[model samples]
Target: MFIPVEAPTAFQSFTLVMPAVAVGNVGQLAVDLIVSALNMQRVGYIHTDCLIPMIGSNPYATSAETAGELHTAAEVYMAAEMKLAVLQIRSPIIQSKSRKFRNLLVSWIKASEFSRTVVLSSSHGYQRDDQQLKGIPLRYLVTPALQVSGDTFKELGWIEMERTPPLPGLTDPSTEPRLSIPGGGITKGLFLDSCDAGLSLAVVLVFCSEGDNVPDAFTLVNSLNSWLHLVDNKGSQIWKIPTSWGLLFGSGIPPAIF
Candidate 1:
């Protein structure tokens, strides 16, 4: 992986936000909203052999002259004044390299001395039990170091994801508590890793269906806003969607085709 700029010093003490490519692509889309809303500038990118290679026009670019600038599989953006940085990963990590990539990320976060990190992720809507389906589709988990940041979560009456109890006769041989997140890709692993390593990490995720997950992204980001106060709740401000979103799914089939 590549850290092109002077990332360590530039984002010291910053709170980094990243999304796992989980179900419905919720995390990735939510991060897109954050990057566009904050107008965050790209400082560098993480180029890893483990991720599916991808390249596209810069989604956060506003000016015509630079609209075609390249965006990589993973890019870093920052609002230095606020000590907040975002690492948006647009590609899926290969299964064999997932653990290595997670270790690499944790190392960078440690070496960079980031004050905290927030991971936006999602799980399959179909798997939620009745209890999980009763409230808002959101749930969160916080590392010990992130307790202070979770105050708003408590105030908001959000649920913390429950550990799936082992079946009466089908328990695993391991004794440690299990955190199962079906369809969440590597989210549980990453969060658990951070917790084990004593990093100030918070994971916020939603249970969502597959189609049109845009609303889920908004809800997730707003949940984050409640904690980070990234934007005032006042009506004076509004979340602006990026112009590049117009091409998200590409042009649809011609009406005549049907």
Candidate 2:
């Protein structure tokens, strides 16, 4: 269920952005950069039992004054002037309820009547095939409903995620290429759901690993910025790193350890 802090209708026709729980959590970190940099307002939250319940101090709080405000597992933030909305998911989905969660998201997206939806995600770098390893680490996918021309991506110098043969190095003609996103939690499912529903959805993701992924996050967000131009990047230090990110590696080591 989506519980609104303001009018639910405020989301209508807005472009929705969200992250998939995947390897390195790069998508979530990119979203953090967007929210902190834009100073978007909290609009609503999706209260679903499908995700593990969790809460903490505001991740984007800039000062002592705002530090104590609570934030939940999944919350919506909006930059109304830009007609953009972001859904940040901080907790993992319950394994048994993954399908349910995807369905819930699809339904909410449809009901909200969003102009389009963008999913940010990451996949395992080591799993890439020879072709996947040859180019830039970034890739994109757009559902048919978007009616996006291949020329659009070609002009942007972006590569579409390729479908690989189910069995690599196999000579059998019966085998067909298929879309695969190892470690991209729910990304494939949600995209397929959007496709079946004829929703305008696109997925932007990076190939990455599982440690010190901060740089990967920057790379992913920068790639997204190339397409969306969400912020002016001409200046130095444009994207603000949220205060919460400071503790990403955890509190300082104890003096006794030395």
Candidate 3:
């Protein structure tokens, strides 16, 4: 359920952006960048039992005064001027409740009446097939309801995610190609659900590995910006890195160890 900090109705017709807990946490990291860059205001929380419980100080806190504010596993932020709302997921979903979580998200999105939704996600780079290996590591998928023109994507120079054929040995001529997103948690499922519900949704994802994926995050977000024009990328304008990312790798080495 959504517990609001302000009027829930404020989100009407807004575009919703969210992340999937995928490999290297690329999606989540990308979301952190957006929230930090926009300095979006907290609007609500998606309180549910489907995700593992988590709570901590605000990740995007600008100063000591705001640093202690309580933040939960899933929270919503908004930039009304941009008609954008972002849902940041901080914890993993309970394996057994994954489906429940997806259902909850779909129901809330429908109820909120968002103009469109974009999901950020990542898959294992090593899993890419021959065709996938040839171009840029990023890919996108749009539902029928979005009704986006292929010309739009073509103009943006974006590539659509491809459906791969069956493995060599299992190649039955009648067998169909399949859409696979290895390591993208709940992404494929959520996309399919949106398709079934006839919702306007699109997915933007990257192929990455399990490591320091900060660069991949920037790449994915910049690609989205090419389409959404979320922020001015011209001149010196750049995506601001969140302060919380300071210790992403770990603490400093102990002098005693030297």
Candidate 4:
């Protein structure tokens, strides 16, 4: 149930930033970073039964007068001139409808004809195979359809994600072996779906332990920026935190008790 305030015609030929609901909510938080960093405009929302019910004050609203305006579960933002679109999902995908949601998303993506899609996600730190323990905290997955983008990363010598160990008897057709992502929710499914459907897709994610992951979110966004070139590097900061984040922990506690 994707609805468009700007109309579907506008999304044709654009690149997309999408995220899955994964461990530490890293993907969703990275979406927030992208939305804040680009100052993108809200183009629409997805009205679907596939996600948990959620409603809150607009996280991207900048002014006091509109800061508390109500918003929905999934929002669409766009940097139209840049041919960039971001799908920021704020709630968990309902277990039963997850497959349907993925299918519908892929269908919309194909219909819209986006040139590429980058998924920002994360996995449980403990789930990492020994190889993931070293190097940068992040890893990337590139499907054949994403060879061009993958090439750019390869040029940078970025580490490709390690394939999940195959279960003793499980068989996937590939002779090279299939990859698995244990802690990522829709990440593996969506990426595979997009690839099989011939939609160019890539996944950029990290392994992180659970807890306050705001820092992880920033790091992940910066990593994605390295390739997407979404932020200007001239500045000391890659991106600024959204004004809403100032309220994330709420006003400070009174010191009188201390």
Candidate 5:
């Protein structure tokens, strides 16, 4: 579930939220990806409409009644006609605002059979109400370690290996080097890719706001300038609109025209 954290430009920045549910292989995979990418330890767990060991259901159990209910609820929250949907999933185990969902999720992970997961989020436009505190964006929740490990297993053909390999012999084993006891170095590449994805998401937001018009380029340039201006002023900012002083002074133009 690679949910790109982006908002098209037609609207002002607003909060985007989603209910975590158990849909199927795809749903679980997405949930795992986000959790791993953000290194999220203990996010809260919803009583996901689907059954799982975490919910006290038989680990091997299958129930259509439960799965359908969860799907219906998700549909209600994501109606196609609405520009945005706010759906709520039922979770009997959790019922508190102060309770950090992330913490709870960590405990669940420790107890679960699932070995790996990933989560990705962005902190764009996020803020904290308390003067001394700061808001952390969605990106803060990803689990980098797992993502890196998964990539390592994929590239080295180790995920299905029978056992660990022995140290290489002094005499070269065939023309190539034996599998190094330590895995190959792909860490830096993985981290750079992840951060690149985040920045790309931010840029997409800006592009989406501008539409398909020749003048949209100028509009985008101005919007970026405005954003920079706001940063320079420490939040003090104003929109830059096209205006002609002569049109007002030369014609003795009406106030409405001006």
Candidate 6:
């Protein structure tokens, strides 16, 4: 309801905590879009399998030339609450009996001095303008897991909204921003643009754990300057979607499949 008249100007590195499930690929998409928007360097990409104990499994985790690659990703994920945000994207079928497992996972992620976190799910391919969201603010848009049957982890409330797919005819920002990337391949990016109105607008993907579904709506604060609203074609909330990683070679051509 409150839209900014101008953009903000304070730039801060934001970490994105996403599920390590297939849906997590959604997270990659979201990050890629953000990197292009903000023109900032890609932080890091953490592959968290569980949160109860807060463990990161970079399956392909390897040493970088400067180690800054992995460090940046870890830093951003912890930026919200200085800890990791728990996402239930582990499996598509919530087993309904995984209540205990889910609790442990949430507790473990919370144990760490969490700065703040926002939990999101993957899209059902049902693209719409906007949807309704309800919940109290915690730190960074952390909310209840959607798409899950019944109310299992309702304790961790979250907001909801409509889904927004990537727009058509968008530009590829792998090198234009010209930051630095450690890991190669089709990596996604996150873009946080500060507007002149003391407000910030983030165009990012809602990366969820494997089974976690994309959230209908969520809120973001601490814009480079202030706060701003990012709407979709129907004037709904708009988030950055990671398209793909760059080749780092080959004329830096545009990707075929996003």
Best by TM-score: 2
RMSD of each predicted structure: 2.7, 1.2, 1.3, 3.0, 22.3, 18.2
Q: How close is candidate 4 to the true structure, as a TM-score?
A: 0.89
Tell me the tens digit of each residue's lDDT in model 1 across 23-102. 99999998988888788888889878879999988787789877889888998888888889999998889999999889
Q: Against the hidden true structure, what lDDT does model 3 obtain?
A: 0.91
What are the Cα lDDT values of the candidates? Answer: 0.85, 0.92, 0.91, 0.84, 0.25, 0.28
Per residue, candidate 6 scores C-alpha lDDT tens digits across 115-135 of 333332232232222221223
TM-score of each: 0.91, 0.97, 0.96, 0.89, 0.22, 0.30
**Which parts of model 5 are misplaced by more than 4 Å?**
1-45, 48-100, 125-258
Q: How many backbone clashes does candidate 2 have?
A: 0
lDDT of 3 by residue, 1-258 (tens): 999986754678999999999999998999999999898999899999999999998889899999999999999999999999999999999989999999999999999999999999999999888889887999999999997755988788778999988673456779998889999999999999999998999999999999989999999999988888898899485788888898799888989987
lDDT of 4 at 166: 68
Name the regions of candidate 2 deviating beyond 4 angstroms: none
Ranking by lDDT: 2, 3, 1, 4, 6, 5
- The global Cα lDDT (0 to 1) of model 6 is 0.28
Candidate 1, lDDT over the whole model: 0.85
Model 1: per-residue Cα lDDT at residue 158: 88
Better of 3 and 4 by lDDT: 3
Per residue, candidate 5 scores C-alpha lDDT tens digits across 222-247 of 33233222113243432222122123
Q: How far is 43's C-alpha from truth in model 2 (Å)?
A: 0.7
Q: Which model is ahead, 3 or 5, in terms of TM-score?
A: 3
Badly placed stretches (over 4 Å) of model 4 are: 6-9, 167-177, 250-258
Winning candidate number (lDDT)? 2
